[model samples]
Target: MTISIAETAETIDTPVLPTTETAKPANVKEVLAFLVSQYPLCFAQDEHIKPLKVGIFQDIAQRLGDDSQISKTQLRQALRVYTSSWRYLDATKEGVSRVDIDGQPAEVIDAQQAEHAAKLLAESKQKAAEKRKARMQEQRAKQPVKAPVAPSDKKRPNKTLVKGSKPVKAAPKAVVPAAKETIATVAPALLTLEPAMLAVGNKVLVKLGQTPMPATIQEVSLPDVTVQLGSGMVIKTRQDSLYQA
Candidate 1:
């Protein structure tokens, strides 16, 4: 029996279409494993590593696009967390959080170098302490020691003569005038010599309270004079308070 072209076409069966399985998103551990496998040189056991080139996240995203359902943004965030973990591990192992690799910044564990640096720091501190102690001792040696002051003796009161007691008459002796008395009698001559004797750097008597103490003339300005006492004390007073010694 002869069949039309349309009827013959209807008798043919339709071809079956193939189904595609959805991609699964990669977890952080899987991503880390991929990274380690892809760049074996950048990873070490119990050590940290960093990507040398920039845009590493973009490269990884593109490489994992077919197998992973994770977006580039998600992958980048995961890498950040992973990098932080590496830094923390590095700090604990090496005593430093970062290092340099192939002239690029990275993190690593280098126990030997860290220990050496610690040793050097301790030695420097010890040497500084020793120098400071020696300097303090030298300063103490240069300082002058002060002597303790002694207490002054007080004068005892004279005994009063009893009433109705006859006072003893003392024998009178002839008075002889000394050379000093004769010189003192000439006031005009003494006045001219006194001014010449009172000058800076000369020893003078400074009246303090009822007593006159020895002092050196530091300054001889008009109306006032500065003197240094024997106790190393300096004072300023009126010129009249000073006398030639």
Candidate 2:
């Protein structure tokens, strides 16, 4: 096929940049930044790096073409040089470990390093648990243990007058009137009394003379009958106004 003149001209005019190319970081600072951004948890966990494990710093520096500018030994030394500047590498035993980018456990550090770190972590936790147990035991020891009170030793209630305090006299039982005289008194206005008498949270009931009314102790006052009847009717009156069932 004959190539078009416009296509040939366009191809010749446009010199495309090579795609198989890698850019190097400007300096060591840039290399450090890139590494930290890429692998934040490089030196985390028990503050120790494991043997035979790919260190976080080296992997990151190599990926960004910065490793060529520095020697492997030098790079390793720089990474091992722990300082506050490397905030991303803050070691913490409280941190949780999951799979890293390589699908391996994050805390899967050098075997020797991990063994030592694990031992330290276990010792700290053991000390804390022991402290808590000791504190609990101390509290239990300080508590007053009540002996079982025998039924025979229990003091029986006596009906005797005290030297100074007045005796608690029993209330007189309410007299029951004749059945023929007992009758329900009709109310004129159930809501005529003050709402304060039937305040919320108080229990009360409504009665008509000796006859038992369909009522419930929905609310009451200090000396008043403010009741919401079982039939949903609200009434307010004096405690002496309604007779008990």
Candidate 3:
């Protein structure tokens, strides 16, 4: 049975070597050469060394500190300077074997692991989009639907009596006649006084229609006279409208 390099790396853990007080890797190039010799399956070399995993630099720093004189911090600082000169490693764009770093093509030694990581990221994004769509549907379900309004009935004028369909005539008003004038019959004693003698404040008998009433002269003129009747009713008429009393 033949074991693949990917399967072998997963099955066996990297053993922690004892620290040996000797000349440790002095630069990033020497440090990278040591890492490649220890874990040949975890790295690839083209124009430069490229890590197969995302945190390969950190893992190398920790492992190198265990058996080397260099501190993990010093190793990390050197790794930073080295990686900065290379292009950004994007797992999304570079799935599985081939990737471009610093405009140079490199290989992924752990191709299966890189492909698995890319698939997980794609599935996560798909699930998030589905959850967003479901939430939008739930919000729409909670909204109220408006009922349509009905139009009002407008009142129209009573259809113009249907054009001479026996036009209903209005009731006639009652007619009132004008009061008539009459000659008043005076007593023989009062008949002796002449109309010229009648002055304002003089008592006289006046005829209003057919009724003879006694009144006081309020004003006197040649033809018209104003008088106040016994009932306090005032009237203005010709001097002939009066009789001596």
Candidate 4:
């Protein structure tokens, strides 16, 4: 199957090939190509590729549940390849719409999903670059290394030629730096709170992330509570997400 993923834009498409009536796909690539052919609108190659809906594999599995030719394992693999493709990741940016089985718009991708897709694409590119650099280094290492040439007689006219002298020692090769190591750090946990703090008009700290912001509880519905943040922003969240002010 043809897979041309560009740096600026991803290109993942192949010429549609005829499928076997009885035999299963020989490999995952073949399976993906077949999937593209079956759902041309949902799955595409080159620049036209779009992001599939979340949990799309389950939907596809249910739809093609009766098809004996394509097994569930291969179908899942194909979907993985399609979703992880550079073009697909590129299309999963924020504000892009995901497509359903019939190629209809399912939902607009949110910022979280878009950020995750971008991270995956960056990792993929970094891996590819590392592999390419390794290959180049290997090729360079394989070629014959030339010996250092001796100084010409005219250039060293003041000094006599020594028969047993060794050619000038080649300068030492530059040392390669060690790969960076990731340092893991822990974030402080949220402050504990009592159940009574969930009442209306009670000022509590809402955990937005690592930092908690002060908000006055406006309404209490057991686990769900409505509060007005210190910034004048209103939000609804679970009781567990709040802490004592």
Candidate 5:
């Protein structure tokens, strides 16, 4: 096929830069999702998301090229969301291989990288917890105050006359209802868990690094028991690690 002079001139023209600065975050999520669909082996959603190889951004830009529908800025932003995710950080353990854009294994995550990821995950979780607690406190504060409930009336003692020169009535006294007493129950100092005796929701003290922690059973399936610690972290452990609490 013969090409016209105008066609050749048009092909030689400079390419326009992608306009992604004005792109919204929702668009970035859509872009990330598209990437996930294109490379399911490399990317995922929720807790299944995996850690990516270092400098995967350049690899993606190089592969997608200028012809790709999404802009480089949007791709970079989407990558930021993916690699910095909680699941990604959690999965970035030492000795675990980081996957390339095609899901092929690349470099193994090192000790420093794993530790850094762990620290980030912890800080993120702590921030989330603080936000939730703050919201709960704000909600409680907004709630209307309830009126105080009056104490229920009780029967007065039978009147008895005092012996004197003449009949004298006993002195009248004010009577107020006593407050209800709540008895505190302490857990057993040391009690081992038996398969037959343990059930879901049972409170147990599990030693973590030589320190006994109070936890409540969330699930019970034979040898493994899932417990929620006082700090609200849930973990699975064997029956031997638990004691009555």
Candidate 6:
């Protein structure tokens, strides 16, 4: 009978493996990249499955310092193993049903569009400044000259106008067109003046006489309401001043 090496190895059964306490870090960047690349990719839908809410993806990328340099596929492989042990890195769908940024869903705004809008606003302001400067210079050029003073007026305390010489024309006052009155047929909303009313609940549409103006109710005072006509402006109005639709 042969003393088999297999029988000896079987007799010396290995002791049970020790329990693991430490866990590996999940490469969140890789996980996000994989999710983004998935088909029918809706930010709201994909975010629901990520361990970290899609909200935290940017923060993680910033911490990583250069997620763009790393290959997404490689990251997915690493995260697959890393998240296997770490549970928080596990994906779920609790927060992915909607697509609104303020809402629960993960929605991304267009940075390029925002940048373009800012550039346009800056250019518009510069043009307006140029127009204002041109108008001021034009007015300065039109001022009238004073006529020669009479010898008799020199003796008097006040500089009296000469009778024979043509009187110096007074500079004409610049007339500004009056602001069109914002009269409306619709009545303003009767919002309760409280802390809750301060919140941007909703914008009220107005039919000011025959003119329709878009304004959001900003501040609610006792008898007056403030309307925001966009462009970071407010128009204070009395309770009986206008109507809302």
TM-score of 5: 0.52
Q: What TM-score, over all chains together, does every model reach?
A: 0.25, 0.22, 0.25, 0.55, 0.52, 0.18
Model 1 spans with C-alpha error above 4 angstroms: 1-26, 43-45, 65-69, 86-245
> Tens-digit lDDT track for model 2 on 153-234?
7686757677999879787989988679655577544433244444554443355665446455454565765666667777
Model 5, residue 229: C-alpha shift (Å): 65
The lDDT for every candidate, in the order shown, is 0.54, 0.46, 0.56, 0.78, 0.73, 0.43
Tens-place lDDT per residue, model 4, 87-181, is 78888889989998889999899999999999989888887788789999999999999999998777544456579997565579899999788
Window of ten residues with lowest summed lDDT in model 2: 4-13
The candidate 6 region of ten consecutive residues with least summed lDDT is 9-18
Q: Taking the tens digit of each residue's C-alpha lDDT, what string does model 3 give over 1-245?
A: 22222222212223223334366755454554454456555543333334344555565666655766666755565444333322213232334443232223455546565565456545545665687799899999999988988876987654568865987676687787877776567744435337666798988888787666899999987688899999999999777778877
Model 4 per-residue lDDT at 165: 91
Candidate 6: where are CA atoms >4 Å away?
Answer: 1-107, 146-245
Mind giving the per-residue lDDT tens digits that candidate 5 earns over 118-212? 99777777766787799899999999999999986997658655666576577778787797796656644677766665788878888787567
- List, residue by residue over 26-135, the lDDT tens digit for candidate 1: 44444444445444554322334433334556656666666566566556654554443423223334534442222344555368755654554455456656877998
Q: What ordering of candidates by TM-score runs from best to worst? A: 4, 5, 3, 1, 2, 6
Better of 4 and 5 by lDDT: 4
Clashing pairs in 3: none
Q: For model 3, where is the 10-residue window of minimal lDDT? A: 3-12
Q: Which candidate should be chosen as best, given TM-score against the real structure?
A: 4
The segments of candidate 4 whose C-alpha lies over 4 angstroms from its true place after superposition are: 1-11, 14-19, 154-245
What does candidate 6's lDDT look like per residue over 144-239, in tens digits? 768998667445534568889877777798999999997766844543334343434456543445454667877777466787765656787654
- Candidate 2 clashes between residue pairs 3 or more apart in a chain or in different chains: 50-110, 51-110, 202-219, 204-217
The parts of candidate 2 lying over 4 Å away from their true place are 1-31, 38-58, 65-74, 82-104, 107-245
